[model samples]
Target: MKKITLWLAALCGGAIMLSGCNMLDKANGIILYGDEEKVLSSLKEEHKGQVEKDSLSVKLMDTDGKRLMIMDETSAQYLLEKELLQEVKDGRDTEALSSIPKLAEGEAFLFAKKEDSDIGFDSLPDQVNYEGNVIIGDGRAYADMFLVVADEDFTAFEAEAKTMGIIQYNKDPDGIGGFDVEREQLVKIEE
Candidate 1:
């Protein structure tokens, strides 16, 4: 199931972007799947020597500790609708109690969810409650790895990504030619 999800993300992310970043809502977080062993390509030729499959998993790391978590999209959406999020007329202000990994090369992300368990671990099953995907700020980067940020924090994430030489910012409204990551600054596309 996990491998299938990652494959879907890799296959779909590119296609989704082609529809234009306009399809994304800067204020909302999205479900993402990424393979750690694979480096992302702005160009296709660089992918020649890499193996096609890698194990994909969701993870969470913070002051408390790091652990493997579950992905439950419906649960995520429920959390958003039930009013667990911090009120912000523009962009979401909720904290990511749990997250999963996605993105490529140095770019990576942790799809978000609320920690609603007594143990505060893992994905919530449907009978209980669910958490929705939320955009998390910069993930801890290592070597060539990078992080993905929500529309709420695009400006700040952009500045940090630049310093790290990470050139991509998904769904930046200010992106240029659909390859906004190549641009020095973003031009937020209005809905």
Candidate 2:
């Protein structure tokens, strides 16, 4: 009886430890938005010619001639967290938004969204300098949508997230999305 009880206790403790560790490690494979993988799969099947596979995002030039990237939610979430971490490390408090630097001429990226129409774009203070388009294109529509903008605006976005207080950036010690070190080298983002 005593041996059985000890084994049972050890099992329960192991289970608890796994549960805690799994949140960070397993998060990379999850879709934060609704059913994103299914949507991407369907989109790929529907428009085989339009899709170009990239490591981080699916890219194409839409029928309207605007560039598009069908990014996954996790990638965006990681970038968003990366931006916020930089902001906090810079020693800027929540009130530092008004002083956000203007984005360079050619800096933008796309993010996953599911809305039928565009969300916050021009309405976001001019400092953010962001512009977005719906993932629904002329011939093909993406169910798991995206937001497009210059790569420059990521910092403004971090400040906005900080002010909102909705997202908590957790450090991923294992590195993002499980990419090998050779595939993922860190580079400094120049101000």
Candidate 3:
């Protein structure tokens, strides 16, 4: 009976650890690594020889540690919702967290179809909430990736996106363009 009880406790502990791991993964948007360079390195490793070294571009980076957007000549922009972990894994330096850019206190990340157009919020899951001042991009460069502040957890929002479809730039607003949340709500990011 003693051995059996110990085994059960061990099983429960393992289960809890696994659950925590999954939660940590979900907290960050799509992927999380030490820093932007690590992120780029991981991408190169994942894609192997296909990714070019000089064509990478950063569309956006949330200094608050919530999101990141990068693009390469070979693929669409990658929107990464990310946070720097308290502990660095694999001997990576925690100091890299300082590299992320910052925004004004009340300002948060937002996506505009273009500098002149309205903010698109219709396709996101109804559960995701965002209300705050937005800081628009520089407009000098071509930006394709976008990330908006979400008041709620992203699991449901992300799940719904996968179930319906992830937002794409060129896709028309056919009830499917906005992360599949339904309805087409477009408001200007700034007044």
Candidate 4:
């Protein structure tokens, strides 16, 4: 009876430790976005065709010249999370950072959407500069998303703002004197 009890306690302890390790691995796993090969191929094709290099977006347009997909690194990160690519990582039982895709700083890419009419280019902000890491929750039925914007060009910033929606500059107003208006007026406006 004593031996059996000790074995049972040891089994439970081991199970708890293994579960904790698995949870940590899931949290730190590498995330990959869209088809890396396709993006690379499109860039090569564009270069070969002598396409103007100044175009900011490498949009994948439909037959009617409507933007259908975007293949930028940011968008790729979004898609990879959306597609739940983490399954591959989990299946392989690997948590090395090397598993993630390494997107170039200014690489050209393409994306394809299920519906051609869904794609739209968002307008850029007039004066805006921000740098941070954002973790997008799992709202959709797929994996959670995360974006790290270490640096940005106007185009990338605009794309992020559009996709994530404008992050409120101020969560709380500075009270009545927040703006140039009077306190009473601000209160009235709030009302």
Candidate 5:
């Protein structure tokens, strides 16, 4: 009986250590806004292409008319369209979003419904910047989601989880994997 208990305790300790290590690996790096000036400077340095701007956003497109990026002034975000990302992954335009900084490696962008005031990043730290609300989802069931740039070491995730609720969101239908979010522990939405 004593040996069995010791073995079980060792197993539990190993699991806990594994989970802690996984969390550390997912630790977010610095979350910075996509500045238009920085983007333009990079573009000029790389000699990519021209930029088009309307009242809504500033667009950067390649000479072949492939939309590379969109910088939303209101939200202060640089979004890479999905089509471009796919093309790049398929070995077509390998240098598609190279101009933009690749600071989103370990970080995860967790959003909350703007209407859900009861649950949100109320006490965001000085490092985490609220980047305004933006519309998410492509279907008719669109949602107004609030955005925030979480700091490195996931301090924002910890703060939000303590104040609101955190959930794991699985975006793909293949059941591959998911990321942590606020409000619920698990959610799988087909896209």
Candidate 6:
């Protein structure tokens, strides 16, 4: 009887562990690293000509309707000057988080304009939320801030943004474009 009970307890513990792992994966968007290529490709095909050349600043929101990342043209130019970013590269891979130049308070890594039809905001899942703001300046630009939830629940948040037509495709000089979730996750709190 003791042996049976110990085995049963072990099995239950294993099941719980597995369940927790699954939940963590879902929350973190932690797919296989190689899957990033596929996700990036899908975005490229979906968002073409959505980036604005005239815009000077860009922002990325977190899953909790909070600002998380920002980019401005001045920083982009600085990156180009330092050869951290190519003067001209495919936009899809150009705006990666890793490639962004060092940022200070109120600085951004990229810049673009929000499309007309794509205007609007949606709430993220209770687990994750994000919102972004961009500031266009004469010779430079910056992202103000991003709201973030720091939890996992991004599934429902993604769905709601999709329904509201907030998702966007980023474009650059090389004409490469990709689906980016910057604005879609933001719920238009007012009008």
Candidate number achieving the greatest TM-score relative to the actual structure? 4
> For model 5, how big is the CA root-mean-square deviation?
19.7
Candidate RMSDs in order: 17.8, 17.4, 19.1, 19.3, 19.7, 20.3
How well does candidate 6 match the true structure in TM-score terms? 0.18
Question: Which scores better on lDDT, 1 or 5?
Answer: 1
**Which pairs of residues collide in model 2?**
107-150, 107-151, 107-152, 108-149, 108-150, 108-151, 109-149
In the predicted model 3, the residue pairs found to clash are 29-81, 63-101, 123-178
Model 3 C-alpha lDDT per residue in residues 1-191, reported as the tens digit of each score: 99999999999889878644433221101122133454344334422122122212223343333333322212221112211112232332221122222332223343333334443434333332222222211121222324433223232233112111112222122321222122222211110
Write model 1 residue lDDT over 33-138, tens digit each, in one string. Answer: 2332221222222222222211222222222343333322333233333222222212433343333332222332333333342323332222332233343222
lDDT of 4 by residue, 85-112 (tens): 2222322232212123444444322222
TM-score, one value per model? 0.19, 0.21, 0.20, 0.24, 0.21, 0.18
What digit string (tens of lDDT, one per residue) describes model 6 on residues 116-162?
22213354222221111222111111122322222222222232121
Q: Which sections of candidate 6 miss by over 4 Å?
A: 1-39, 46-65, 70-75, 78-191
TM-score of candidate 1 against the unseen true structure: 0.19
Tens digits of per-residue lDDT, candidate 2, 111-175, equal 23322434333423232223222222111222233443334443333211101101112321232
Worst 10 residues of 4 by lDDT: 182-191
lDDT of candidates 1 onward, in order: 0.29, 0.30, 0.28, 0.28, 0.27, 0.28
lDDT of 1 at 151: 26
TM-score, structure 2 vs. true: 0.21
- In candidate 3, stretches whose alpha carbon ends up further than 4 angstroms from where it belongs are 1-108, 111-116, 119-121, 125-145, 158-191
What is the clash tally of candidate 5?
3
Residue 105 alpha-carbon offset, candidate 3, angstroms: 16
Query: lDDT of model 4 at residue 62?
Result: 34
Native RMSD of candidate 3 (Å): 19.1
Q: What C-alpha lDDT, on a 0 to 100 scale, does residue 166 get in candidate 1?
A: 21
